[model samples]
Target: MKKNFTLIFTLLLCLFYIGGNAQTQFWSDTFEDAGAPSSGSRTASIDFSCGGPPFTSYFTRTLPTGIALQNGSYSLFQGSKIWAAEDIDKGPTCTNASISANQQVTWSGINIAGKTGLSFKGLLAASQLGGWQGLNFGAAEDFLIVEYRIDGGAWTKALAFYSNVPAASPASSNQLYLDTDGDLIGDGAGLTYAFTEYSANITGTGTTLDLRFNCFANASAAQELAVDNFRLFEAPPVVAPTVTTTAATGVGAVKATLGGNVTADGGASVTERGIVWATTANPTTANTKVTNGTGTGSFSAVISSLPAATLVHFRAYAINSSGTSYGSDLTFTTNAALSATTSQSNVFCNGGSNGTATVTASGGVTSYSYSWAPSGGTSATATGLTSGSYTVTITDSESTQITRNFTITQPTAISTATGSQTNVSCNGGTNGSASVSPSGGTPGYTYSWSPS
Candidate 1:
């Protein structure tokens, strides 16, 4: 009984191992080991005639120096070798000529079980020798077709290439040349190559896959297509970033400083991160925002031109290739501005000291203090002043003060003078005359004597 139990436990472990391997399945190939065809020789044509489905074909490898001008001189996607359809055909003679029959290369036995998608990358080109003026009459009839099959199903078109077409022509349109170069034969203007990336979504429960690349060419046109760095993998799921909005500080009547932190990037690089604020609740990017550059981590922003004593809502936001994410809402109120007013009374004339100044404070914080320029008490009102400019300063609990100036004018005074007259008879005696005058008042004055 113990032997049977041990055997069952060993089988369970094997099952767990297999399941883990399937979840992490991945495959890739650069075709660098596919030996190059003999000089001036091409592989046999492939027509999917292998009795069943999923037919494979031979691949031709070349070094960067071999096709540098036609294709870029860069090494293969992964190695120094690039794979493509054989360059020369094995028919009548071994020369640099076009193939008499169509040729194809294929990749098979791709296990995509439990996979989400696949991608392929390569470079392709079609050209003829002697420039664009040395091709046969029917050279425009050549083309290359790329197809794929799943679970031995029917082939589906993936990509296609054609020779004898202008470099600027659309892929779906066929370009025709009329031998305008006076060469009497068809030709092409050098070589045109482009790198391409293709992707497809994997559906169903398929476990195996196949891909084919077929090149059709005329008897006089030298056509070629190269593929390199072909890879297959499961697409990762998209996730949004995680961020947090901290409390605000440095609050003022018109500005405040806010802070935020990006805790996680959500499996992707953070492209945009910043803080957003609004006068209402639940702020978003539609409101006032400040960009704090890219990447994750902590950031701070100062919001300016805000209204005084206003309630503001703010939050942190981060964006990645997947989507934008926002942090929790934060609230803060701006400090109120100081508002104070003053009233004054002028002093009386003739050196009278009855001037007064009163200061009234509002808004801002309470617990105010008053100060006078000359010399006075801390009360809001200041009195006993002559005639001149007087200043009073009112300070709030926040240490913010407002100073105002007041003036008191001098008043007019009156004066009179008299001289005793000697009692003298009606005779013309100088000592018997009396004199009186008025001064120390307005220039224009009038007086009347009683008993005149």
Candidate 2:
């Protein structure tokens, strides 16, 4: 079998940063306690010009009974106390009191100076009386409007809703009606009283602002509008991407595969992601790095031509509009190259002994363990009788092994002898005889006598 000499090592580079960009809560109210200064109240009369701190007694409207100021089974409102307009307190002659009795709440002098943007989230639902039942009811006259004044400037209508408005009501550039069921009235008898989420982006700038929520019914009786979980937030700065590193895979002595994942892009988009590596700890983009591609998610890259048997640090990283982020640091070392040399001794003759072979290794960890095939013992040198093939295996400290082969051959032997000859007269024929001999070789050797 052919042997492959490639060695592989992997070091995981996890580069990461903690914390992230988050939105700041400028104000929030659950209206669990009507007595709390932050919790606003409802009035039965209309005073369009009345502006004061929330929950303060500044309005002159009679507090109606049907408009429950305490918490109840209303699924729309969060917590205990929800501001609801009901028909429980109607006088013997009262009907659709929300029209004749106006309810309004105000938050005054709110500071929102260098905020990027403003947003609000709340639950809102309107029940209709004397209109189409279920989600199809059309109570176009019932109104809920939100108005805001920046730095005490002229009040501008930010949002408005009319429960009975038709689905095709003319789209107003400044008004947004709640169409929870894609109908004019968001709630009806067929649909149990359930709250729906409402959100809007606050536009325009202000150092000290005033916000108002006003609701009233035009001609319908037994109608109610409930609001809860009101919150105002200041948009935070752009956020950085989140990233994590995966384990590295070694391809060979000098190459490995690095990987990572981008879990989030904070509210911005991720523009770049990949791996970075270096010889020291906490490798960053300033070190050697690879760009897998843009956007958030999993990515991988192959690193090559790395030094052998050296510790390396690496990590995954991602970049977004807010900034760059990295995973934790990881470490790995490459495999060392192995090399060996061998020497062999030949046997003196066929079936003779004294054959030996020795091996030496370099470029590997020290205190190496040695082994020889065919029972040559666990030593660098192997000595025994007869000539044949031999192999030596050496293992380094890291358990990496290298094997070398050597061959011992039989030595060739030679000897010669001159023939003894009787002295013969120059021309005496049969009286002269000569013989020759050879040894240390196969028999039947042929020899030629000199001057013959």
Candidate 3:
């Protein structure tokens, strides 16, 4: 005969951790205060264990020996009830009086496909078993087994709660989970146990997540075992998220739009995502960065104040638990400011309209369209002439434009003199006047009258 609670430090309390990452809780159950079974099933076995079998009934319609209960009452963790397997001598409910043995309850069809960092949590408690003393046939060997499996894979142990047999129990300590170094728990100090929270992690992948809870108790002692409040969670992976960089779009003088798409979260949520750029071959967040925002998805940001006609290398990035991850290196050149120059011929005569102007445009978007204010000409080359200041708006395919002004001049004609005279209105009044108007040469006029 062996003492119970061989897994006190492991299955009962816990030794492994699920890390500090936050988890996504998906399901939970607090074993309602539902009425007890009308009759207990799963007869106790001559042996004991999670896989114990070939059970042989020692009693029929068994009830707890101590703690009087007329109708029996099942404890509740959430509503007013809990899943409990009372001691053999007494039934927790008035309905079921038979002691439970080699029995288990299962929850099936839980979908967990593509999910990672899975963890299971629950509550449990147990009373003293008689087997520790080696006094009678009912050595305390009853326990609880909680386990799960993915996509119908082999059932993996998530958590387990065993009968508390103590560490220093008698010669029957063989069943005390003795294999693993330092696995034995308790100092045989207390005879009873209290409720404690337990947790376990489920690593790997599967289509459906399934769970099972097993309880095995006998009628030999006044002890009992109970369970409540079961919970499951999916935590973010500890690895970096997967992301891809998109080519720069809307490249223009002084600014450009950069973006990326996050393909996978790497089992974790993306805390940040964005684009980084620099004139160098490989740019990092340290250079110039545009924060699109948090989370995984397609995002874009516009980097401004960039020098024109310059080549820049950039990359997209995402942040998560495992740190930062970047997309492939990408490069682009910003458009230079649009510009133009005009070559012209002065009007042949001072007031001639035959003067011509031709434009040679460079930089900015390709396709060009020219609009001349005075001539109303649409082509890059304008004719028909005019002796005056004119402005041509040079526009590119993207609606970007530039203005240039130039003057046309003709050599001053060999003084073509023309004069107008008015006879004196009043004979000696000196009111008569002589004037000359000049065209095409420098624009202003000057005259000198000799002795009126």
Candidate 4:
């Protein structure tokens, strides 16, 4: 289970933000109890207008119901209440409300002492209801000006807002914000008068942070503004990404397929991921590696041109801003594509079973094993073979094998084709004729023909 950090900001409403990673939330405010100054929350106001109304307060916290916007009245963006500069009751003689001149309202001293990567956001709603059709949006400072500062340092301007008005302004440009959806009723009612969210990233750290909204007006026209639901966030700490090395597949003498999985990114983007291999165990990126791609998820690559009949070690890896991380080492062994050579001796003489078939295995693991066919031989050499066909199956230690087929042959013995002898036609005669023809065996018949 994951730990949760959230605060309920309102009585009837619950407001909070969930971090993308395991990030921490420093501070947040929904202004749930915003009311008259008598409420005494962490808020202050200042009035700087000519007879700034007949009121002692510069701002009033109330339910957001913007009536001046041409589109329609405003509603609370969140919770039940908001801090606004608009006046609820305008006196008979007062030409402007409490937010006439350089009036300001501040929500101060929100703690963020040791926070880094500070991000903040809030909701704002307003309209240029009365005059000055300006779209410059606080460019020259007219309506609500949102500013923030750290540890009471120099205030940094963030965003400004305006309201509904005529399309053209007689003096400076106004009506920077209006109901642009065309559903509202006003001269320049195109932009929405609804409350919208605005966010900004803040750098530097301090014990406390302050948010201030300054409302500037000519003390002649009526304007409305409200602020609500401000939140701050901090990014999660970064570490090396988590990755797992998968087992090698399709392993061969010189090639293999291997890959890995990026289970977690450790709060940072995985910029690089790949595989590394070497003859030794625990290989690293400094060794032979194939970079697959960027980001998370499963990826694979082929490692080729490896030595034959060797044991290789490989690992999967991933890279992020934090650093590099590797998976467990995986091992695979390659056999040398078994092959063999053979020498055979035919039957020494006809009708003799002394033929020999011998095989020399190579291209495989050392101490090779051999099997001969015809149910008589199991070693490298097969002996006592007649004139017949035979086969030998040579296997390596790694279960790789090769079969060699050979024939045990025999030679014909000497024989006579045709022969005749002149029978002693003239026995013991001085002119006795003898003739004979012989074939077979090795040519050149010898003259040891019996009765000499």
Highest TM-score, which number?
Answer: 4
Whole-model lDDT for model 4 versus the true structure? 0.64
Better of 1 and 3 by TM-score: 3
Instruction: Pick the winner on lDDT between candidates 1 and 3.
Output: 3
Q: After aligning candidate 3 to the native by TM-score, how far in Å is the CA of 119 from where it should be?
A: 3.6
Instruction: Tell me each candidate's RMSD, in Å, in order.
Output: 16.1, 14.7, 15.4, 10.2
Q: Please give the TM-score that candidate 1 achieves against the real structure.
A: 0.38
Runs off by more than 4 Å, candidate 4: 1-25, 34-42, 47-58, 65-72, 87-100, 107-118, 132-141, 150-153, 162-174, 178-193, 203-209, 218-221, 277-290, 304-314, 328-452
Model 1 weakest 10-residue run by lDDT: 48-57
Error of 2 at 425 (Å): 23
**lDDT string, candidate 4, 1-452, tens digits:** 00111222231122324324444555667777533222213555542212333332225555544223333565446666666653422322344442234567776777776566777666776653445434433332345656778988998766554444434343433554533243222233222345566655777888877877776544334345567776667776788999999999877666778999999998789999999999999999999978999899999877777778889999999999999999999999976766778899988666888899998887654667878887446899999998789999887655666799989888777666566555455658665555557554335557665575
Q: How well is each residue in 1-452 modelled by candidate 3, as lDDT tens digits?
A: 00222344243323343345667767766544233221122222221211112112222212222222213322222334345444332223222333344456666777777777789877664444333322132444444567787888888766544424443233343221211122223222232344456677887878787777765555433334556567777864468888899998888876778899998787667888898888896677788878888887898877776777998899999998888899999988888778887799887766667877888998887888888977738988778777777788998766767888866666566363766889899867978777766554645546556764
C-alpha lDDT values of all predictions:
0.57, 0.59, 0.60, 0.64
Ranking by lDDT: 4, 3, 2, 1
Model 4: which ten-residue window has the lowest total lDDT?
1-10
Residue 371 of model 1: what lDDT?
A: 83
